[model samples]
Target chain A: MRALVVEDYHPLRAAIAQALRGEGFAVDESGDGEEGAWFARGTPFDIIILDLGLPKLDGLEVLRQMRARGDQAHVLIVTARDRVEDRCAGLDAGADDYLVKPFAVPELLSRVRALLRRAYARKDPVLRIADLAIDTATHRVQRGSQDIELSQREYTLLEFLALRAGELVTREDIRSHLYDFRSESGSNVIDVYIGYLRKKIERDDLPRLLTTRRGHGYILGPA
Target chain B: MRSLRWRIALAGGALAALMVLAGGAGLAFYLQHTGEQRLRVLAASQLQALAHGLEFEHGGIELHSLPESGLGWALYKHDGSLLAGSAWPGMAPPGSKLAAPAVTRITTPEGQAGMLASGWFQPDEDDRTGGGEISASLVFSTADIDREQTGLLLSCLAVSVLTASLAALLLAAVLRHMLRPHTDLAEKIAALEPQCRGQRISTATLPAELVPVAERINGLCDRLEQSYQLAATFHAAAAHELRNPLAGLRATIEVAAGPGGDPASALATCHQIVRRMEARVANLLLAARLDAGQVEVRRDEVDVNDLLVQAWEAQATRAADRGLEALWDLQGSGIASADPEAVRMLLANLIDNAISHADRPGAVRLQATTTDSWVTVEITNPSSLDGERAARLVERGRRGASTSSDARHAGLGMGVCCGLAELLKGRFSVSADGRELRAVLTLPEAAEFTYW
Candidate 1:
């Protein structure tokens, strides 16, 4: 998954982006509301963290523009404005969730998790494809009662593919979800990470679950 | 019904009563004098009538004016002997010789108080009395004079009391009518709120007599409104100031303690925020001291050149980071009897402001000049602000830009520098011509004194 953080305070923005990246979500960042709004229009993000006290434009204005443009990314309000009225206004302004500042990192992460879950309509944190199992909560994979370890990049590729196990996810879709605004990735890196994921999860003894369709995209299923 | 109204009425009633009483006394005195003169003249006329009716040739000089009007008359010689007498019922003639025309209080036959007159009057050459005296003294009782005087005085007092009461009532009514505006003004004042911008004492609608009072009240309210606005602004600014660093602090702690966070970066942020907060708190303390009027001026010999170098060194990195060059043209080594801390703060503030607003790759120039009487320091930087902004830059909470979005000094540097300069007997000024902003601090040179 990919998430964007739009906050003015540098340390807070950096910390949120770092925590999201640690959680296997590629995070794009904007230091101000204007840039944040522009990023929202240009990028396809699954979730967005917004701060109200942003320079150039307000977070609410950015949210308004995003909604006006029909961008359906789950927006979580992370602001210093803790007033109940501000919370109500943010929610009314199409905010998916509201989190006041000085919030615990785990709480923010859980809220983001909840929002993403609601967005994708995935009730379970663990995805299953026949004999292969991937816990989306902790990025742990197991196949036929055998625990498997994967690198951060390889694990992200697997999670993205497993979330849409029955459907075909194109290379562009995989690339958009794998890398953030800060990182520009070519097609070869995605293919290389998919190769690494195949080696780890698709054992010769078991039925191959992670497979690729010719001239289409990669899919995670027993095919 | 108010005490003020009652007091006014009481004062008016007292003055009115005094005036009425004085007028009544004057009228009574004049009436009494006129009555006494009329009685004296009537007495003389009666004496003449008595002399005219006297028949001295027979029956021992009959007095035709006696028993005629209840007037008692007697003709006495020089030895107190009655030459001729005519007495009314129970009326007695005086047995003393008459010296001159005299009017005295005497008792009539009815025991009533009356005016009596006795004098020597020339009678007709015909038979008047048995004596060959050149003048026959006549005495007569005054009739009805006392009753008439008492009646006149009583009437004057009655009219005075009635008129005074009416005048007092009229005065009370007029006073009530005249003070209506004052009462209305009081009500308006009672409803006024000094903090409200709309509430004001209506000087234009007030009476002319109290226009000045209303104007003063309005002026006081205006001052109060201004102070209230300033206090509100200060309160908001203080909150923002506190919240800014608090946000940074919380974020730093969260970032350091959170998973996959960089401790080094958080440590740096914490240090930076701590330093900025300390500076802000110190400035607030100084402002409090300034407000309390407890600023003690230190008479210390300060090296301006050293202070300037330190301030320049502190700001040079920021200037260079923004691709700006900080250049110092040290014309002279300025020295003065100044507070070292104040001088250092002033230099730091000026240089920091210059560096913060300097265009990227532009030049920030500092110049110091010392004369026999003054030590001047000037710092100039490329700026986009107009001359008007530069002029008011020294005002508290005033910044180079119109908005608070700029991350420069947070609007606490130049204003405090100006205040400190003033406390050190220095003149601080800013000059901007759109292209360049220059701040000048001209401080008086103190006499060299070594008490250490």
Candidate 2:
């Protein structure tokens, strides 16, 4: 999963970014609203963490502009404005969730995960395809009675594909969701990660759950 | 008369009653006087007719015809002796001689009140008395006049009492009608809720006389609302200032507690965050104390040069981190008689502001000079703030355009510095010139002060 943090405070922004990155998310950060808006407009982020008090442009205006331009990212407002009216205004202005400052990082991460789930139209924290189970809350995967261990990058890619189980996911989609702006965009990186995921999740005794369409994309369910 | 309406009504009613009493008395007196004069004229006419009717055909004179039944007449000689017609007992006294026509109040034989007229008159020519002059007296009963005057007085009294009562009621009713708007205004003011925004006494339904009063109350309400809004904004700003650092502390702790997290760096950042929060809270408390005039001042000889060096060194790390260079020029003895702590706080805030807001890769300049009785310190730095923003930089809770760039600053440094300068009996001012922002503090020299 990918996310964008638009907070003005440096320490807080860095901390939130680091926490999200640790939770297997491709996190991008901006310290001001203008740059945050620019990043939101240019990229397809699964979740956008926004602060109300930002320099150059207000967070509400950025959200308004983003919604006006038809960017459908789930926005989670993280601000120091704890007033009821502030919360209501933030939610009314295209925000998926409102979290006041001084909040617990675990709660923020939970809300971010919930928003990502809502974006994929999934209500349960765990995604299932036949016998393959992916627990989004813990980033753990299991097939039948066997537990599987995967790297962070491998887990993030698998979770993205599992969220859209039985649907075609393009390589461009994988690249956008798995890699942030700072990461190098190399060709065949998606195939290389997919091979690693297949080696771990696929076994000779179980039916293959991952399949690739010729010259098209990859899907996470039976063809 | 504690109530205005009652006061006005009672005053008006009392005045009306007084006027009615005075008019009633005057009318009663005039009516009595006129009634007595009419009785006197009746008596004189009756006595003259009796004299004209007198005849001397026999030894005694007789009236030509009997006088009216209510009239009592008597003919008397010049010697004051009753001759023929009868009169009231006091009409012709034996020793009293009738020399001229006179009217007097007398009692009739029946004890009825009467008016008597007595005078000497010529008898008929063929029937003359001893000297051709006869004195006659006529008594006219005044019982009717007394009854009419009594009735008139009673009627006047009754009318006066009735009119006074009616006047009182009318006056009270009119006054109440006139003061209805005032009553409504009082009720409206009493019902006003202080927390309700835009609540005001409506002047549209008020009388012209009360419009100004209502307008003044509305104006006061407007001012109170503005004060409330200002307080709310200040509170929100203070909360934001505190909560940002708290969030940073919490996030840092959470991250440092995670797998492979570096606890040492996290502790350092946490300490920094706490320190920043402490400074912000201290600034807030100082601002409050300064506003309430609760801060104490002590006169001490303080070296401005040393204070500047300490302030600069304290912020040297921040300055270096921001890639800002510092330069200083000290001239003369930079000594001032002021509160040492106050001076230190002021200098630290100014220098910190200079470093925080100074353009990166630029220089911050500090200059100190001493005149005959004053010590002046000036801090100048390259800034992108416009003149308008620089002018308002010292205002409480006002931040710069790049508010997001500096999280450690709560926008209270310059304001606290301004307050401390005032507490120390110094002048502080900020100005913007092109791309440079400057702050100057002037304090009294040590020689110009006496021990406090």
Candidate 3:
């Protein structure tokens, strides 16, 4: 899948593109709102991320055109304004979701997935990789033919890893997904959880679907 | 009617009433005393003239000169005999005539007097002329007395009444003039408005006694102007700083969710980041609004319980989506005095903060109580003592700190919540349990207390 990033600031835009590439999405970039609007209208995009404050054509206008042209592509609006009126205005301007800037990479990837899945009409809401399966509807997990009974917290951890499957999820990405958890959560908690999941799934009989990426988070996919 | 003006007017009116009464009473007493003294002097001199003209001849006492017109007299002898000369005309005895004359006092119709002439009789038994039994004695007519006394009293009372009325009018005019400056100053003060921050109380030509007071008012205005300027600057800077993070977050989401993307993976990541950024932004803006005191509270009759249910609905989805649990113990239809929008925002911020900070798989408790005059809502979540300190850090985050500094606790969430509470004119308190955090907000009951 491909995505478009519209931002005026160079450093911040580059950082965003780097984060998206790391998440395994092909990223197309625009420095201003006018060019961003042209790219959005001329090219078919799977998702369009917009900045509210942009040079030339404003980000809100770009969003308006995308919706006006019957482009049903998933649109996420990102802005520095967290005011109630600002949020209302963006949603009114045809944005599917709103994001504030300076966010962790994992958060960006998660919202991207929720929007894309609804757009493409994925039948199995639960994600499957080899012998491991994650049920999004019931918050359930299964390894091979056996049902794996995990704690609510352990389920949340596994869901984050399963969302990306083969991609290298970082420690920061895992931390960001654990919204209810704190930055002070122990550094090895992820490694320990991965160990617990391997034992519970009886990895010997099932194919090894969960693998650690050294300093990064565990990946749930065949290498 | 309850203000200082009414109070001062009442006091002035009472003073005027007292002055009118005292002046009227004093004037009456002075006129009566002077009138009595003047009447007595006139009557006594008349008797003196009658006594000086007495003459005895041929066995009878008679007046040598013509009797005074409009005067009448009667004489009594020691033998209880009565005599009257032709001058005695049709005189009657006065009510205040002396019963026995000597150097005696009397208050006749003629007015108060001291009679000086003796009352005696000379009989014809000495055989001077034909035995006619003639007798003589001094007499002063009391008729002249009445006319002269009445005239004196009427004149004196007329003068006294006129003088007293004039005095009262003068007194009132002076008092009202003395009070004019104070009343004028009071009116100016009452008319002052908050928007008139630059106004200086002009007592430049006022009475010397009010100069210091006017100077103090001017000094206060100066302070108010400085504070207002600072607050405006803070608001502008805060808005500018907040937009940076917002722009960056949207840019990342647009690219990841576009064409060459793993639509599933990129969209999921974008949702998480947006939710987190929204939380931070909401809190910061709330603080700025609170600091500026710009929250417009459109007050309405609101059910606290209903407001809570709505707030919980917004938050419950997010918490469930994150694998968290929520519980509530709400009072049924608790009525409160509040702005509905303000109350909802208050509830939303607190609940969202709790859902984000509460322990995973742990329960968040929301409880509400309503009293006759106030309603209170409290939210309890998993927390520790360290969390309490961290919460304090968040509360103070937006005030006078370097935003560029990488401080973990100095994000916008708690600061905005604190600001919102102030703007709503409600009370907010945060405390930590052994392993939980609690936030409580108290608002007035609209049925009992009004916003103003």
User: Which one wins on lDDT?
Assistant: 2
Model 3, residue B294: displacement in angstroms? 27
Per-model TM-score versus the true fold: 0.70, 0.81, 0.39
Give interface RMSD, every candidate, in order: 3.5, 3.2, 9.7
> Top TM-score: which candidate number?
2
lDDT tens digits by residue: candidate 2, B1-452:
29988888878889999999889999989888898887777777777776676668766655576456446777777777667777555776324445546888888667788777888766655664576556777777777778888999999989999999999998988888889899999999998887648899988889999999999999998988866765664576577778889999999999989975779989988987887678778777786666556899899999988999998997788788778888889997888989998898888888877876664368899999998688999999887656766767677656422234332352577877887888888899888765887999999889843334
Query: lDDT of each structure?
Result: 0.74, 0.82, 0.61
Error of 3 at A194 (Å): 31
Error (Å) of candidate 3 at residue A98 is 1.9
Evaluated on chain B only, what are the TM-scores of all the candidate structures, in order? 0.71, 0.74, 0.44
lDDT of 3 by residue, B1-452 (tens): 45554555456655655565566556556665565555445444554455455554666666655335323444444333454453232222232334332332333445533232333333434433344433233334434554665565566556656665665566556656776777777777777777557677798667888788778877877877867755653553455444454444455555555545454554555565566557556655656556556667676777778778788787687778656777889874477777787677677777777765553457888899887677889988774435445446344443333221211223344555566556556677777755777888887767643333
Model 1: chain B TM-score relative to the native chain B:
0.71
- What's the ranking of the predictions by lDDT, best on top? 2, 1, 3
Please write out the lDDT profile of model 1 over residues A28-135, one tens digit for every residue.
998767788988998899999988656557788889899988999999998756668879989998999998766777788889988877887888888788978888
Look at candidate 3 and tell me the lDDT of residue B263. 49
